[model samples]
Target: MSVFADLHRGDEPLLLPNAWDHASATALAAQGFRAIGTTSLGVAAAAGLADGASATRDETLRLALALGSQPYLLSVDAEDGYSEDPDEVAEFARELACVGAVGINLEDRLGSVALHAAKIAAVKSAAPDLFVNARTDTCWLGDGDGDGDGEETTARADAYQRAGADGVFVPGLTDPADIAALVERLHAPLNILYTPTGPTVPHLADLGVRRVSLGSLLYRRALGAALEAAAEIRAGRAPHGATPSYDEVDALSRRGDLTHSDGP
Candidate 1:
């Protein structure tokens, strides 16, 4: 198994925090997150594009290239692999692997199951070592807790795994019973998206979740904090959080480089 794969088999579920840019990724790595993921929403929003619409492919690749050489492991959220063509998606995955990305997340968006599976298989064929977290939007796009939805989720997950996916991600699944049932049935590692209103990390681990992804949560919270900070300044009140000094942020920008240079 790969190093990234080993993270999922640990005692506690691998808490993968998604970063938007080089600074955020290095900052999270500085704080000791061994594996860092790229958030598609964060990437798209930063580039003034839309998420889940196959936009921001270049922006995503750029971010991956910027951060892939960093110390932490990188798992990019490719957002349907940026195309409907499985071979095209596989080519993209190959580029990511060449730049040192250890994993990629491909979502179905409740589209054609066969096409999604084909993409997964093609990615595995192109970048055999790259961990593929096949995502299905059944829970995200449908009624998550219904019995019929659970069956659909299971069917999709099964198909994805058979197509060479290293793991399965169900973003909108929150109910503990449903999560446990899915975990029991999946042959691949079960990845659950961590939500504020959902089961706690330990609870998910107890339910047999191998990976817990903070998908867009940290990026959204970071944006919220910036807004709140500006509001507090306008109101003549101090912000209520640990603020990093200017030099601290500057240092983060130069992480992994032997010496800092004034020119870009």
Candidate 2:
């Protein structure tokens, strides 16, 4: 198992933060985060493309290559693997693994369970070591209120696990009972998206969540902070929050005193 996979075995849940670019990732790594994940919305929005529309495939790969060399584990969020064809998705996973990504996240987006399972199987066959976090949007895009029971979610998760998924993610699920139930049912590690109004990190750890992802939340908040700062300056007021100095931002590129780790 990879280091990233071992992170899920600890006493507490792995609180994974998602980054959009090199600077964001480096800043997060500077805070001693063992692993970082890419957000599909952040990547697509940065390139002015639509998220979950199968676009930004090249952009995702390019970003992965750039961040793969950093001294921390990197996971790329490939939206639907950029294609419905299992072969194409498998090839994409292979390239990501070749570029040093230890994990890959593939979402179903409420699509066919069989199709997503096939994609997971193909990815596993092509890159067996790549950690595949199979995501189901049943609670997210399906019933907007996050009210869907665990029947469909469990069925899909079961299929994905059978197809060799390292973990299963159910975003937008907030109910504690539902979360605890899923945790008990799934054999693979259960990953949940961290929601501000939902369970806190410690509470999630108590609920048996192996991994907690701040999916696209950090990216969106960064954009919000930038805009708010600009607005405050325009209004002739000083900005709040911790702002890095120019030298500090520039130092992210200069890797001179830093020892690079060979990531899994």
Candidate 3:
């Protein structure tokens, strides 16, 4: 198994923080996060495009190529693989692997289960070493009740695993009982999206969740903080919080010999 895949086998669940840009990714890596994932929403909104509509394919690929040279394990969130065709999805996965990404997240927004399974299979067939985390939006785009009964979710997860998925992700699922039940049923690693109102990280680990993803939470929080700080400055109040100095922020741009000589 690859190093990124091995992270899920440990005793503690891997806390994967999603990054939108180079600065966010390297800052998280500086804090010792071994694995970093790209948030589709972050990339889309940053590029002035809508997410989950497959509008950020080029942006996702560009970000992957940029972060590929970094020291951390990178996972690209290719929403629906940018194509409904399984072959195209598989080729996209291969390209990501070639660009140094060890993992790719493919989400099925409550689409046909068979189609999603085929996509997963094609991805594995194309890049056997790439860790495929098959995501199901049954709960996310479901009836909005937060009740993730194992019926549709389990069936999709089963199909994904049989299709050779390295892991299964069910975002917007906050029920501990439901999460535990799904974890017990699925053979592959279970990844749950971290929500402040949902079960805590340790609680999810106790329930057998192998991975917990922040899933755009950090990106949204960063934006919120920036807006709040700007308001505070406008009110003539001192802004609080740990802000990186100019030099510290500049240091993150130093990628070996590729250094920026321009000043702020």
What is the per-residue lDDT of model 2 for residues 119-206, given as tens digits with 9 covering 90 to 100? 9999999999999999998899876676475799999999999999999999988888899999999999999999899999999999
Q: Candidate 3's residue-wise lDDT over 111-209, tens digit each? A: 999999999999999999999999999899888777655699999999999999999999989999999999999999999999999999999999999
Of models 1 and 2, which has the larger lDDT? 1
lDDT accuracy of residue 244 in candidate 2: 88
- Compare the candidates by TM-score and give the number of the best one: 3
Off by over 4 Å in 1: 144-148, 255-264
lDDT of 1 by residue, 138-172 (tens): 98888655233888899999999999999999998
- Model 2, 53: alpha-carbon shift in Å? 0.6
TM value for model 2: 0.95
The 10-residue segment with the lowest total lDDT in model 1: 255-264
Which 10-residue span in candidate 3 carries the lowest summed lDDT? Answer: 253-262
Stronger candidate by lDDT (2 vs 3): 3
